[model samples]
Target: MKPTITITYCPKCGWLLRSSYMATELLTTFADELNGVLLKPAETAGEFCISIDGEPLVDRKAAGGFPEITALKRLVRDRVAPDKSLGHSDRVHAKPDSGKDEK
Candidate 1:
Protein backbone atom coordinates (compact mmCIF):
# COMPACT_ATOMS: atom_id res chain seq x y z
CA MET A 1 0.00 0.00 0.00
CA LYS A 2 1.16 3.53 -0.71
CA PRO A 3 2.20 5.60 2.30
CA THR A 4 0.56 8.80 3.50
CA ILE A 5 2.57 11.91 4.38
CA THR A 6 1.32 14.12 7.15
CA ILE A 7 2.40 17.67 7.92
CA THR A 8 1.42 18.86 11.36
CA TYR A 9 1.81 22.55 12.04
CA CYS A 10 0.74 24.91 14.78
CA PRO A 11 -2.24 26.93 13.60
CA LYS A 12 -1.76 29.42 16.40
CA CYS A 13 1.76 30.01 15.22
CA GLY A 14 0.55 30.72 11.66
CA TRP A 15 2.12 27.65 10.22
CA LEU A 16 -0.92 26.38 8.37
CA LEU A 17 0.13 28.02 5.10
CA ARG A 18 3.56 26.52 5.40
CA SER A 19 2.13 23.08 6.06
CA SER A 20 -0.27 23.37 3.14
CA TYR A 21 2.50 24.41 0.80
CA MET A 22 4.55 21.41 1.85
CA ALA A 23 1.59 19.12 1.31
CA THR A 24 1.14 20.45 -2.21
CA GLU A 25 4.77 19.93 -3.02
CA LEU A 26 4.77 16.36 -1.69
CA LEU A 27 1.57 15.50 -3.46
CA THR A 28 2.96 16.80 -6.73
CA THR A 29 6.34 15.16 -6.43
CA PHE A 30 5.13 11.81 -5.13
CA ALA A 31 1.90 11.50 -7.03
CA ASP A 32 2.73 7.97 -8.08
CA GLU A 33 4.13 6.81 -4.76
CA LEU A 34 2.07 8.45 -2.02
CA ASN A 35 -1.53 7.73 -1.23
CA GLY A 36 -1.95 11.37 -0.17
CA VAL A 37 -0.63 14.23 1.95
CA LEU A 38 -2.53 15.18 5.07
CA LEU A 39 -2.34 18.65 6.55
CA LYS A 40 -2.86 18.40 10.29
CA PRO A 41 -3.31 21.42 12.51
CA ALA A 42 -1.15 20.91 15.56
CA GLU A 43 -2.56 21.31 19.01
CA THR A 44 0.70 22.18 20.68
CA ALA A 45 2.06 25.68 20.32
CA GLY A 46 5.03 26.19 18.00
CA GLU A 47 4.78 22.63 16.80
CA PHE A 48 5.68 21.59 13.28
CA CYS A 49 6.44 18.11 12.11
CA ILE A 50 6.38 15.86 9.09
CA SER A 51 5.71 12.15 9.22
CA ILE A 52 5.05 9.18 7.05
CA ASP A 53 2.34 6.85 8.26
CA GLY A 54 2.51 8.27 11.77
CA GLU A 55 6.27 7.74 12.01
CA PRO A 56 8.02 11.02 12.63
CA LEU A 57 10.42 12.04 9.89
CA VAL A 58 11.27 15.50 11.19
CA ASP A 59 10.40 17.67 14.15
CA ARG A 60 11.01 21.41 14.10
CA LYS A 61 11.77 21.57 17.81
CA ALA A 62 14.38 18.86 17.58
CA ALA A 63 15.89 20.18 14.37
CA GLY A 64 15.86 23.79 15.69
CA GLY A 65 14.22 25.03 12.49
CA PHE A 66 12.07 24.10 9.54
CA PRO A 67 13.72 22.20 6.77
CA GLU A 68 14.15 23.71 3.35
CA ILE A 69 11.79 22.42 0.68
CA THR A 70 14.57 20.69 -1.17
CA ALA A 71 15.76 18.89 1.95
CA LEU A 72 12.24 17.89 2.84
CA LYS A 73 11.63 16.54 -0.65
CA ARG A 74 14.81 14.51 -0.50
CA LEU A 75 13.82 12.99 2.82
CA VAL A 76 10.39 12.00 1.54
CA ARG A 77 11.76 10.69 -1.72
CA ASP A 78 14.24 8.51 0.14
CA ARG A 79 11.46 6.78 2.05
CA VAL A 80 8.76 6.63 -0.62
CA ALA A 81 10.89 5.99 -3.67
CA PRO A 82 14.43 5.07 -2.84
CA ASP A 83 15.41 4.45 -6.44
CA LYS A 84 13.84 7.61 -7.76
CA SER A 85 15.92 10.59 -8.80
CA LEU A 86 15.17 14.19 -7.88
CA GLY A 87 16.97 15.79 -10.81
CA HIS A 88 17.94 19.38 -9.91
CA SER A 89 16.72 18.96 -6.38
CA ASP A 90 19.17 16.11 -5.83
CA ARG A 91 22.17 18.08 -7.05
CA VAL A 92 24.70 19.00 -4.36
CA HIS A 93 24.82 22.71 -3.69
CA ALA A 94 28.52 22.83 -2.70
CA LYS A 95 31.19 22.78 -5.33
CA PRO A 96 32.78 19.38 -5.89
CA ASP A 97 36.31 18.90 -4.64
CA SER A 98 38.90 18.47 -7.41
CA GLY A 99 41.77 16.23 -6.40
CA LYS A 100 43.71 17.19 -9.53
CA ASP A 101 45.96 20.29 -9.54
CA GLU A 102 44.06 23.48 -10.43
CA LYS A 103 47.11 25.34 -11.76
Candidate 2:
Protein backbone atom coordinates (compact mmCIF):
# COMPACT_ATOMS: atom_id res chain seq x y z
CA MET A 1 0.00 0.00 0.00
CA LYS A 2 1.17 3.54 -0.68
CA PRO A 3 2.19 5.58 2.37
CA THR A 4 -0.01 8.30 3.78
CA ILE A 5 1.56 11.49 5.09
CA THR A 6 0.07 13.23 8.12
CA ILE A 7 0.83 16.82 8.89
CA THR A 8 -0.19 17.51 12.48
CA TYR A 9 0.05 21.17 13.35
CA CYS A 10 -1.14 23.38 16.15
CA PRO A 11 -4.06 25.40 14.94
CA LYS A 12 -3.63 27.62 17.97
CA CYS A 13 -0.21 28.47 16.63
CA GLY A 14 -1.62 29.33 13.21
CA TRP A 15 0.23 26.56 11.50
CA LEU A 16 -2.64 25.41 9.33
CA LEU A 17 -1.47 27.38 6.32
CA ARG A 18 2.05 26.13 6.70
CA SER A 19 0.88 22.56 7.06
CA SER A 20 -1.47 22.83 4.10
CA TYR A 21 1.25 24.24 1.90
CA MET A 22 3.54 21.38 2.82
CA ALA A 23 0.74 18.95 2.09
CA THR A 24 0.22 20.47 -1.32
CA GLU A 25 3.88 20.18 -2.19
CA LEU A 26 4.03 16.59 -1.00
CA LEU A 27 0.91 15.65 -2.91
CA THR A 28 2.18 17.23 -6.09
CA THR A 29 5.62 15.70 -5.86
CA PHE A 30 4.56 12.22 -4.72
CA ALA A 31 1.20 11.94 -6.41
CA ASP A 32 1.94 8.41 -7.56
CA GLU A 33 3.93 7.32 -4.53
CA LEU A 34 1.59 8.44 -1.77
CA ASN A 35 -1.84 7.28 -0.73
CA GLY A 36 -2.80 10.76 0.43
CA VAL A 37 -1.83 13.65 2.69
CA LEU A 38 -3.72 14.33 5.92
CA LEU A 39 -3.79 17.76 7.52
CA LYS A 40 -4.49 17.29 11.23
CA PRO A 41 -5.04 19.96 13.83
CA ALA A 42 -2.74 19.26 16.71
CA GLU A 43 -4.13 19.32 20.22
CA THR A 44 -0.91 20.26 21.88
CA ALA A 45 0.30 23.82 21.79
CA GLY A 46 3.05 24.62 19.34
CA GLU A 47 3.00 21.09 17.98
CA PHE A 48 4.00 20.58 14.40
CA CYS A 49 4.95 17.21 13.16
CA ILE A 50 5.01 15.19 9.95
CA SER A 51 4.28 11.53 10.14
CA ILE A 52 4.14 8.58 7.81
CA ASP A 53 1.78 5.78 8.80
CA GLY A 54 1.73 7.15 12.37
CA GLU A 55 5.52 7.14 12.54
CA PRO A 56 7.02 10.52 13.20
CA LEU A 57 9.29 11.82 10.44
CA VAL A 58 9.83 15.37 11.64
CA ASP A 59 8.91 17.48 14.65
CA ARG A 60 9.18 21.23 14.47
CA LYS A 61 9.98 21.68 18.16
CA ALA A 62 12.59 18.95 18.12
CA ALA A 63 14.16 20.26 14.94
CA GLY A 64 14.19 23.82 16.41
CA GLY A 65 11.97 25.01 13.52
CA PHE A 66 10.06 23.93 10.44
CA PRO A 67 11.85 22.40 7.51
CA GLU A 68 12.00 24.13 4.18
CA ILE A 69 9.61 22.82 1.52
CA THR A 70 12.41 21.19 -0.44
CA ALA A 71 13.70 19.44 2.68
CA LEU A 72 10.24 18.20 3.53
CA LYS A 73 9.70 16.89 0.00
CA ARG A 74 13.02 15.06 0.08
CA LEU A 75 12.08 13.45 3.39
CA VAL A 76 8.75 12.21 2.08
CA ARG A 77 10.24 11.04 -1.18
CA ASP A 78 12.95 9.10 0.59
CA ARG A 79 10.35 7.08 2.46
CA VAL A 80 7.63 6.67 -0.18
CA ALA A 81 9.80 6.49 -3.29
CA PRO A 82 13.45 5.93 -2.57
CA ASP A 83 14.44 5.76 -6.22
CA LYS A 84 12.32 8.71 -7.30
CA SER A 85 14.11 11.80 -8.58
CA LEU A 86 12.94 15.14 -7.19
CA GLY A 87 14.45 17.23 -10.02
CA HIS A 88 14.90 20.80 -8.68
CA SER A 89 13.83 19.73 -5.21
CA ASP A 90 16.85 17.43 -4.98
CA ARG A 91 20.06 18.43 -3.23
CA VAL A 92 23.00 19.62 -5.25
CA HIS A 93 26.04 17.53 -4.55
CA ALA A 94 29.64 18.60 -4.78
CA LYS A 95 31.29 17.97 -8.10
CA PRO A 96 32.94 14.58 -8.46
CA ASP A 97 36.69 14.41 -7.96
CA SER A 98 38.69 14.66 -11.21
CA GLY A 99 41.91 12.69 -11.36
CA LYS A 100 44.01 15.57 -12.70
CA ASP A 101 46.94 17.43 -11.13
CA GLU A 102 46.15 21.00 -10.09
CA LYS A 103 47.81 23.55 -12.40
Candidate 3:
Protein backbone atom coordinates (compact mmCIF):
# COMPACT_ATOMS: atom_id res chain seq x y z
CA MET A 1 0.00 0.00 0.00
CA LYS A 2 1.25 3.45 -0.86
CA PRO A 3 1.80 5.92 1.92
CA THR A 4 -0.14 9.16 2.14
CA ILE A 5 1.92 12.22 1.30
CA THR A 6 1.10 15.40 3.19
CA ILE A 7 2.41 18.89 2.53
CA THR A 8 1.62 21.56 5.08
CA TYR A 9 2.26 25.19 4.23
CA CYS A 10 1.49 28.57 5.63
CA PRO A 11 -1.69 29.79 4.01
CA LYS A 12 -1.34 33.16 5.71
CA CYS A 13 2.13 33.40 4.26
CA GLY A 14 0.52 33.16 0.82
CA TRP A 15 2.01 29.76 0.16
CA LEU A 16 -1.24 28.11 -0.80
CA LEU A 17 -0.33 28.01 -4.47
CA ARG A 18 3.06 26.54 -3.68
CA SER A 19 1.55 23.85 -1.58
CA SER A 20 -1.05 23.08 -4.21
CA TYR A 21 1.59 22.94 -6.90
CA MET A 22 3.65 20.44 -4.95
CA ALA A 23 0.61 18.32 -4.32
CA THR A 24 -0.13 18.25 -8.01
CA GLU A 25 3.45 17.40 -8.88
CA LEU A 26 3.51 14.51 -6.46
CA LEU A 27 0.16 13.28 -7.67
CA THR A 28 1.26 13.41 -11.28
CA THR A 29 4.58 11.74 -10.59
CA PHE A 30 3.33 9.13 -8.21
CA ALA A 31 -0.21 8.68 -9.45
CA ASP A 32 0.01 4.93 -9.32
CA GLU A 33 2.19 4.77 -6.20
CA LEU A 34 0.64 7.23 -3.79
CA ASN A 35 -2.53 6.81 -1.89
CA GLY A 36 -3.02 10.57 -2.20
CA VAL A 37 -1.33 13.91 -1.65
CA LEU A 38 -2.81 16.32 0.86
CA LEU A 39 -2.33 20.07 1.05
CA LYS A 40 -2.87 21.43 4.56
CA PRO A 41 -2.87 24.96 5.90
CA ALA A 42 -0.46 25.59 8.74
CA GLU A 43 -1.84 27.13 11.88
CA THR A 44 1.54 28.05 13.20
CA ALA A 45 3.33 30.91 11.58
CA GLY A 46 6.25 30.01 9.27
CA GLU A 47 5.50 26.35 9.13
CA PHE A 48 6.07 24.27 6.01
CA CYS A 49 6.74 20.59 6.08
CA ILE A 50 6.15 17.40 4.16
CA SER A 51 5.39 14.14 5.85
CA ILE A 52 4.89 10.55 4.85
CA ASP A 53 2.50 8.51 6.91
CA GLY A 54 2.90 11.10 9.68
CA GLU A 55 6.71 10.89 9.59
CA PRO A 56 8.39 14.21 8.98
CA LEU A 57 10.28 14.20 5.71
CA VAL A 58 10.92 17.86 5.08
CA ASP A 59 10.73 20.69 7.59
CA ARG A 60 11.41 24.21 6.39
CA LYS A 61 12.00 25.44 9.89
CA ALA A 62 14.69 22.88 10.51
CA ALA A 63 16.14 22.85 7.00
CA GLY A 64 15.92 26.64 6.72
CA GLY A 65 13.76 26.94 3.58
CA PHE A 66 11.52 25.07 1.22
CA PRO A 67 12.66 21.72 -0.09
CA GLU A 68 13.75 21.13 -3.67
CA ILE A 69 11.20 19.21 -5.77
CA THR A 70 13.68 16.53 -6.80
CA ALA A 71 14.70 15.88 -3.21
CA LEU A 72 11.10 15.64 -2.14
CA LYS A 73 10.28 13.26 -4.96
CA ARG A 74 13.19 11.04 -4.01
CA LEU A 75 11.94 10.82 -0.46
CA VAL A 76 8.44 9.95 -1.56
CA ARG A 77 9.62 7.49 -4.18
CA ASP A 78 11.77 5.68 -1.65
CA ARG A 79 8.88 5.00 0.64
CA VAL A 80 6.05 4.54 -1.84
CA ALA A 81 7.60 3.43 -5.10
CA PRO A 82 11.01 1.94 -4.52
CA ASP A 83 11.13 0.33 -7.96
CA LYS A 84 9.87 3.39 -9.81
CA SER A 85 12.40 5.45 -11.69
CA LEU A 86 12.45 9.22 -11.21
CA GLY A 87 14.33 9.80 -14.48
CA HIS A 88 15.86 13.28 -14.37
CA SER A 89 15.11 13.60 -10.70
CA ASP A 90 17.64 10.88 -10.09
CA ARG A 91 20.46 13.00 -11.42
CA VAL A 92 22.74 14.32 -8.73
CA HIS A 93 23.47 18.01 -8.77
CA ALA A 94 26.34 17.63 -6.33
CA LYS A 95 29.55 19.59 -6.69
CA PRO A 96 32.01 18.21 -9.22
CA ASP A 97 34.34 15.52 -7.92
CA SER A 98 37.61 17.07 -6.74
CA GLY A 99 39.57 14.39 -8.62
CA LYS A 100 38.23 15.67 -11.97
CA ASP A 101 40.69 18.11 -13.50
CA GLU A 102 39.16 21.49 -14.24
CA LYS A 103 39.33 22.89 -17.80
Highest-TM-score candidate: 1
Ranking of candidates on lDDT, top first: 1, 2, 3
Candidate 1 per-residue C-alpha lDDT over 1-103 given as tens digits, one digit per residue, 9 for 90 to 100: 9999889999999998889888988888889999999888888899999999999999999999999999999999999999999889999888787888877
- How high is each candidate's TM-score? 0.90, 0.87, 0.87
**Over the stretch 1-103, how does candidate 2's per-residue lDDT look in tens digits?**
9888899999998989999888888888888888999999988999999999999999999999999998888888788888999998886778988988898
Clashing pairs in 2: none
Residue pairs in collision within model 3: none
Cα deviation at 96, candidate 3, in Å, is 5.1
Please identify which of the two predictions, 1 or 2, would achieve the higher lDDT against the true structure.
1
Q: What 10-residue stretch in candidate 1 is worst by lDDT?
A: 94-103
- RMSD per candidate (Å) reads 2.7, 3.7, 2.9
Question: For residues 1-103, could you state the per-residue lDDT of candidate 3 as single tens digits?
Answer: 7789888899889998989888988999998888998888889988999999899999999999888888889988888878899999999879967897769
Give the poorly placed runs of model 2, Cα more than 4 Å off: 93-103
